[model samples]
Target chain A: MHLTSVLVIGATVIALLVLAVYVIAVRTPEGKLDHVGGMRLVLWLGAIFPTVVLTALLLWALPAMRPLPHQSGDLRIQVQGEQFWWRLRYEDGNGPGVISANEVRVPVGRTVVFDVTATDVVHSFWIPGLGGKMDMIPGRINRLVVKADKPGIFRGVCAEFCGLSHALMAFDVIAMEPSAFDAWLASARGVPARADGRGAELFSANGCGACHTVKGTPHTAMIGPDLTRLGERRSLAAGTLPPTLESTAAFIRNASRFKPGARMPAYSAMPIEDATEIARWLRSADGEAGR
Target chain B: MNRDPLKWHERLRVSLWTLIVPPAVWAGHFLFSYLWASISCAKVGSFARFPTLFVAGTVVALAIILVSGWIAWKQQRMTGDPPPHESGTQIDRLRFIAKSTLLLAGLSFVAVLFSALPVAFLSDCR
Candidate 1:
């Protein structure tokens, strides 16, 4: 602890001892000691001392609580919260930048500015192991600054009670090395490869194109997550499913089975085989299928 | 609602208002200043012209605190008056309440001032 905290704690302890000695050890009604200093102690030490201590602590914490400057290596990303999802825009430092959903990427050892906001109900963006939560109020953008020292996939949850699927809404924070992050960004710009060509055709034909977007494809919609890099994600439906072919297929077929009250309509009528193919296609889209 | 005209409480409502006003002003100022600074600063990603908001808010809050303090001082001034109707203890209780409220006013004044200190050093609310 710092010297101020130590002094505060020490003063508090000494004050407690003095109070105990005065209140419990000394008899007040029987007049064991003088009463003149008693009122002075109560007024000065009891009341004013605490106020001074708290004020000092607040003063001490003020500087540390102030937001840090966005360093040269800082990454800027805008996170917009919806009822049950997060829309992300990574400031690629070039052009309008890379649009994404659910998953966020940042280089380890670099500060990240999450310019958080929401479209519908209020939501909060929180990465518990990383930093504090910032509210994403509708019509108001709140920024949360954080830094990660190690490269890992940290799970983030919506700390606000936004809607029915609030418990299911989540995202993944993938902190990678700067070189690896640049490579990932570069790959995200290109077309996603699919294990099955039929799945791409099915994805468009089923009207799923109206909500989701896959870059280099005709179907560009703003309602759903950008599927350009969906295959490269760690989880789907806001971390409700593992990034696997079976989970993808299952979620596409009947998302309500995994997460009841999910916003996506159930596609139970889709043929089991077609669902499996589409799931494989999405799984491949994660960019791991080629490896 | 069941207030009796003969009781000291009926006469003491003014003093109670005096006790309550400073903290209420403090709460309003605290919330407004933080939100105004946060929202305005957030929109532009900078603290440009934010010091004005801070200054205006702190000044308003300090003025309110001062006015309430003066009211509490008036209530305490009335503590010297002798009880009129077989009620010396009632006067003493009034004095006690007034003294306590004055002390609270002092503490809350300090709190209001302490809260404003952040606006001076912290340029942004991000």
Candidate 2:
């Protein structure tokens, strides 16, 4: 059974016992016990009983308080908390780190250590189902070690109250089998295949390359999130919208409409057809080929 | 070594201020434990492997509280007129203070143990 279930059951039993004692005390006739008798009762029931119970409980829970043991060879993921998004880099000692955004993937049953920090302000990294929350403070790295017992997708959110649009900040946590995770990581490290079309032309024409990076192309500057594997991500704009053609186009055109105080400039003047074409190019499988 | 109950009670000289001793020890232990944990984390990046100093501090605090409680318990058992102890006699006053101190000592003993619990469990700052 889960630890929470055990705790809840224990608490319920204790509450029922306390209630029974209360009923017995209330039903007793007046003057049935003298002051000395009452004192003895309080000494035994209130003082000694609680001390023994609490001591036993403390001993029982002591071993469980220790965190999962980690070694230097374990996979380390560096997560930096920005104003409205998360920057992730996975280092597994195989090759150069794989940089991604707004999502986290870990191997099931393997210990994953997160070296979490912040760039601008204080943010807390929380995935409630997996482990405890760790504060991401600027300039200081806080470590969170976790081992996913099962393979599934979970949701993680910024627990701290960052600036405007903080409520919109969230990410997906994907736990996969070890072999699949290795395959994904190997594929994620290679450069993406080049995309060429009217949408690709418009993407360059709009100067999107100045901020975002798409590997295997000349758009190497990374002021914004890397768009190499944009097509594979489950959500858009740091989980603000679905990864659909229209939603991506709308977000590209007027990002501030969906998220207030977004850093991306509002391209309201750009033609709707042009935005849709760029979104299509980005969402195409060939556009996300290698990374 | 006097066998006279009244003389022995007077010799001990229990006072109203003695009531604060047990809880004060608890509070001191509580503060020291937190400070030790914080300093250890900040300096060494984790709690000490053995934590001998923390263990020693806890032992001393528990010993002082136990001694206090033992004294109060002995005083509480002294023969006196029972409840509705409204009389202003010296013996009644001493007995009342002793009983209150004894209860507080019991509470403090439990609190000190609780404060020491986290150290026994967590080996790291996380």
Candidate 2, residue A11: Cα displacement in angstroms equals 2.5
RMSD (CA, Å), each prediction: 7.2, 3.3
Candidate 1 per-residue C-alpha lDDT over A60-165 given as tens digits, one digit per residue, 9 for 90 to 100: 7778667767764457899999878999988857545788999998888878888999998999999986787899999988878888889999989999998778
Clashes of 2: 0
lDDT for each residue of candidate 2 in A1-291, tens digit (9 for 90 to 100): 566887898799889989998998899999998887997898887878878977877787777668888999999999999878898899999899999889899999999999999998999999987888889999999999999999999899999999888889888899999999999999999976655788788989999999888777778776778777788888887878887889988999998899898788999999999999988887775454222
CA lDDT of every candidate: 0.77, 0.86
RMSD of 1: 7.2
Query: In candidate 2, how many Å is residue A244 off?
Result: 2.7
**Per-model tally of clashing residue pairs:** 3, 0
Candidate 2 B-chain TM-score: 0.88
